[model samples]
Target chain A: MNVFVIGLGLIGGSMALDIKTSNKEANIVGFDANEAHMEEAVSIGFIDRKGTLEDAKEADVVIVSIPVNVSLEVIPKVLDIVKDDTLVFDVGSTKANICTALENHPKRRNFLAAHPIAGTEFSGPKAAIRGLYTGKTNIVCEVEKTAFKLQERGFKIFNDLGMRIRYMDPKAHDKHIAYVSHLSHISSFMLGKTVIEKEKNERDIFDMAGSGFESTVRLAKSSPAMWSPIFEQNKENVIETLEEYIANLQKFKELMQQDDYNAIYKEMADTNRIKEILKGISIKTS
Target chain B: MNVFVIGLGLIGGSMALDIKTSNKEANIVGFDANEAHMEEAVSIGFIDRKGTLEDAKEADVVIVSIPVNVSLEVIPKVLDIVKDDTLVFDVGSTKANICTALENHPKRRNFLAAHPIAGTEFSGPKAAIRGLYTGKTNIVCEVEKTAFKLQERGFKIFNDLGMRIRYMDPKAHDKHIAYVSHLSHISSFMLGKTVIEKEKNERDIFDMAGSGFESTVRLAKSSPAMWSPIFEQNKENVIETLEEYIANLQKFKELMQQDDYNAIYKEMADTNRIKEILKGISIKTS
Candidate 1:
């Protein structure tokens, strides 16, 4: 079984590691634009060898895990070279554009649009770890477009990697992801910016910051290289979530200004139900 | 050592647990407006017994850990009854209001204004855990107002509990805390509100939510009873931080609307410095 992993970063490297673990005969080939990352992935023993896009021709499976913008240009070319019977998938955050771009492709049946929603604030080949997808949700968009045999192949890999699968249309995936994922990144970035601006004047302000502040601002440390494209691809939905978030913040400030402690207290108390809503979901924080 | 813990919640109860661990001769007398909490604290072995306000006369140390509004009312009476040798301190989030309210009290020398920057999202006696303050910063405000002997006594307890002490003025503490602590709470609460509102129209929104969203919204689970008073007392500084935060959000939204991906990328890349700022600080997520 020949598996070619493009963009040997967190997601791709991790997927290769897990696939190697599950299938003893699997040969993992890594291709990253960064020469250092491909070398690191091989040195780290996650990838069996470093290969070029030309090597993807013989692959039984090819996984594309680059930034969304780069994936837009690279995935169609990957599809252009892979065998008819080969299973190919791209694990990018935004799926609508890639799915729409590949709608009329000759090998469309061989391609699957998947988003394994699992990651840390860190990135790169060294950031990859085994079992990264375990117990995480993998939203597969436009599954109907993929061939039945390839869908089975993708599900086999997802199951072996210990991920729960949810299917949705590509457009709906982008809209919903804006609320749950993209908006949080924007919120964290702005919070970090606001505090950094104030920290210039007040040097010791961080001494007063507790675990709560740390938790709320953790996403501010995510890689801009991976996230900027996601926000761009999902601009309309991201903008909508940001507007709603800003309005909610303004309303809270108004309540405080009016000395309406009752409303302020009630607002937080209402949001406290998030504890119950988020109950079985465990977030790893190191 | 007759140590009276005036509230059997997360902070006070945890303090009692640690103090008793350090001082074998110490007797922890628990008191809470909630009778169930005092009883539970005693039964849980964090406190040796339940006590009333009259017991404060015999207290060698009084640790006040209640809502700031309640502390304003109860702390004065605790000082009036405590012995001249007793060390009385309140561990609330806001400092300036309580410090000013007791500025000219007859027994002001017996009081030390301190804010221990530690806690999880949970509350109550059941939420109490050992070593909650270990390796955490304890900001002591208005230390000069307290008697030199009482300040030494307070420092001894902080040292025994493995806490790092930093002296700060009450007004400065409040203002800085608004940026690092209060503002983050407002952001988390508003994020949770925005998502919950959207969840009304889209039921499966949270299904796509990952660890990033979970971490960013964790503070929304905090107790409103405790936070409302902190925000009210620190209103002016809190309002300032909110305005700055809202402006930053608006600016980010404008950049998105203008389709300036370069600026968006730079904004997040700049804020990634938070990883360095928070390197040695560990926040307990579970």
Candidate 2:
């Protein structure tokens, strides 16, 4: 199979590499809106060659991984060009917008809307890592909308990369992701902003910071170009999640202000249940 | 030297183990108000023996590793009981309260107020791991107040553990820690709470969650027995820092609601400076 990957950043570049490992004969080509990333992906050996949108149309499998905003504009065009038997899918964070955009298109059945629940804060071709999808979850949205043969190819491709698939409606996928994934990035970004704005001594942060601070702010280093449009595309759900998050912070703050030690302890103790919920999300180490 | 460790949890227990590694002859005695913790410390070989508070009086070095609120109440009493030559110190998160408690004691010069900027969400004797402090930052507050000879022992102990020491005033240490460490915990705990409350499908969370969510909410599992007291002791600084953090979230949320993608993008791009600041807070891998 020839796998063509669009947007040669962390997701696309990594998937291209893993797909080749799964099937050595599979030729992987890449394209990115950024000229430098296209060159970097090829140089990094993540792809067999740099391909164009036209080249992507002829491929056996097409994986689109651009920012959510750009994905809305580009996925349908890819569908318009791809062969009928070819399977084209997206690895974007949000699903509703992409699903809606291609809902009534002539080649709608040729596209599978997927959100590969994997990635690091770092981005671009250089940030691509091997086995990133191993033991990670992949949510396939609106699977019933896709052709059966294309869906079968997706199942085999994702499984070869060691992923667990869960199916959901596009609207449900977007709503749940707002609370679980996208909001986490925003919270972390705001945390880094809050610390930088409040503390003048970068030296103090470096000196007094520990594992807790590092993990909490790690997501703040994510690519702004990739995330800003995600927030824009999932505007309503992201805003709703932020409102609850901010309200929870304010309530906890008031409890602190009143020196309500019991309440404060209860708040953290209750939230500790996250330990159980988190056990289900596993990262495989080689 | 005979070292007495009061409160044999993750901090004291790990420190005891590392001290033993540093010098095999170091006679480390353990004391915890909780009987099970003391028994576990002895069984795990983190300490040479499980001793009492009274037994702690004659040791050449005393390391206090209790919650900050208890540190305020117990540190002064420890200072009253210990011999003049004893080098007493603490590994609490907040420093101002601990420093103030021992400020008027005759053995004020015997105590070194220290906060080792290291640890995981887990606590207690079983959670103790060797070399937890190696390549970690150790912030010592009011170093000038410690007797010259005892301070020498501190320099050696921290150095043997492979920790880099940074000097700080107690007041400044508490204030700086609020923004860098305490705020991060609160933000994480509340993030976990908000998600659990809003998203009823724990299965969806397990499916869609990524590294971003895992890292952001990891600190939610931290012990309330430890953090509540730290928050209570450093109430003013924490409250002030939370105010700024909340305000920043409000501004970011408004930008999202307004669909001001450029402003949101700029907000994250500006905070990306954390990537550089974080490079300085390196974790030593053995």
Candidate 3:
């Protein structure tokens, strides 16, 4: 199969690597708005060659793995140019906006909207690594809207990549992703900001911070070029999660003010359930 | 050296493991206020044998690695009982309060106040792992207060464990640790509490959260029994850092409320300096 991948950043570049691994004959072509990223992907052997919009349109399969807002503009164009037999899909984080943009498109049936629940804080073609998608969840929203043949091909591709397939409504995907994914990044961003702003000695924070701080602040290193627009496109749900987060922080702060060690202990102990939750997460991801 | 380790949890047990590896002839005896923790340490080979208060006073070296608040009560007693030849030290997070407790004690010269800037979110004897302290920073607080001979031995032991040592005053250690270490834990804990409270489906959160969420919320899995008292013992500094953290959250929230994507982008980009800072950190620790 000849596949053309748009936006050869972390996700697209990673999937390109996996696709080549799964099927040796799969020819993967990469394209990115940042020509440098596309060149890096090819030079690093993440893809067979670089391609154009026309090249993508004519390929056996087209996968758009660009940022969410970029997807709104580019995915529909890809759909317009795609051949009758082409299988198209996107691996965007937010789903509703892109799904809405394509609702009435004549080739809507050729496109599958997916959110692969896999990524790291790092970004760009340089951040690509092998086995990024294996055993992770692949969420396909509005699956029924995509043509039956497209859906079957999409499922087969994801399964070949060793991804667990899940079907969900577009709105539910956005709402849940806001809580599970976007909010975590925002929380980490704020944490890094607060520390950098408050701690006069950056060297000290670095020296004294343990692996726990490293883990908690890791997401702060994510690409702003990538994320700011995500929060913008998914404004309603992201803000709601942020507000709930602030409320919780305030409550915890009040408990600190009251010197309520008992309540603080109970709250933290309750949250330790995340240990079990993360254990479950690692098993699935592992 | 016959070393008596009080409070055989993560730090103590880990240090004991390194002590054994570094000096096979060194007899590492364990004593914990928690009898089960003591038994578990011995059973798991974290120590040579369980010991009593007499054994601690008789040992050539004594290490206290209990929770911060308990250290206040136990440390002074250990100081009172230490023989003139015993070199005693602590691995508590907060140093000021413990230093204050030892200020007028006659055995102060024998006690070196230390905080090994190393730990994971998990706790207990089971959490002890070999090489846990390797390539990590060990902050020696009020080094001048320890007898010259004891200070040299303390630095030598930490060096033998593959740790880089830094010296600072007790007050500064507490204040800086509040921002770098304690505050990170609170941010993570509140994040977990907020998600656990707001997101209705625990299973869904577990299923959907990516490695980013796992990293950001990892500290929420830490033992409250360990942290709440660190917050209490260093109440003033912890509260100040928390206030600054809250203020940062509010500023970010206001930006989101105004839909200021530009400011959001700039703020996160600024905080992304943490990437370089963490790079420097790994270089120092590695």
True contacts kept of each: 0.82, 0.88, 0.79
Could you give the interface RMSD of each candidate, to one decimal?
1.6, 1.3, 1.1
C-alpha displacement of B221 in model 2, angstroms?
A: 0.7
Q: Rate the local accuracy (lDDT) of all candidates.
A: 0.91, 0.88, 0.87
Q: Where does candidate 1 stray beyond 4 Å? A: A283-286, B283-286
lDDT of 3 at B281: 70
Residues B1-286, model 3: lDDT tens digits: 8899998988999999999999989999999878999889989997989888778777889999988888888888888888897899999999999889899999999999988888887799999988988898888888888899988888889988999888888888888888779988988988888788755653475678888888899899888988999988888888888888777878887898899989999999999999987887777666
State which candidate has the highest lDDT. 1
**Model 3 lDDT per residue over A27-63, tens place:** 8887898889988998989889988888866688998
Off by over 4 Å in 3: A200-203, B201-203
* Candidate 2 per-residue C-alpha lDDT over B245-284 given as tens digits, one digit per residue, 9 for 90 to 100: 9899999999987878899999999999999878877533
A56 Cα displacement, candidate 2 (Å): 2.7
Error of 1 at B166 (Å): 0.2
Cα displacement (angstroms), candidate 3, residue B283, comes to 1.9
Task: Considering the true interface contacts (CA pairs under 8 Å between chains A and B), give the fraction that model 2 also has.
Answer: 0.88
Worst 10 residues of 3 chain A by lDDT: A198-207
Judge candidate 1 against the unseen true structure and give its global Cα lDDT, from 0 to 1. 0.91
Error of 2 at A200 (Å): 3.6
Model 3 lDDT, full chain set? 0.87
- Number of the top DockQ candidate: 2
